[model samples]
Target: MSTMTVRMNEQDAELVRKFAQFEGVTISDFARTAILEKIEDSYDLQELREAIAQDSGERFSIDEVLTELD
Candidate 1:
């Protein structure tokens, strides 16, 4: 239970209000969800970057994977 105040230009505030109403959510809920989604997106991008960095341009066949599972 906390309160956060955000300052924006009138045009931006109106846009957000309209969008939240269109989506049938309170502005607070819409903003919260948007913030959380952005955070998740950042984490996902970081993981993708790390995986790409670790990739050695190597490919494994299905048989090789199955044999290693034994």
Candidate 2:
């Protein structure tokens, strides 16, 4: 495991502490989970953007999907 140091203004620190306390987690745990979720969201957005940019004009409707499944 590794350690990293983060500095924040007192107000922001207090907000994080309060939220952590409310969620029954240590400040570090809360921050770690928040950071991981944000990273995952960014990756998902990038993948979506790439897919959209690669669009080949193929189109589908709900009925078409259901008929194919049937």
User: Model 2: how far is 32 from its true place, Å?
Assistant: 0.6
- Once superposed on the true structure, which residue ranges of model 1 sit more than 4 Å away at CA? 60-70
RMSD of 1: 2.4
For each of the candidates, the C-alpha root-mean-square deviation to the true structure, in angstroms, is 2.4, 1.1
Positional deviation of residue 70's Cα in model 1 after best superposition, in angstroms: 12
* Candidate-wise lDDT, in order: 0.98, 0.95
TM-score of 1: 0.81
Cα lDDT of candidate 2 equals 0.95
lDDT of 2 by residue, 1-70 (tens): 8887889999999999999999999988998999999999999999999999999999999999999999
**lDDT of candidate model 1 versus the reference:** 0.98
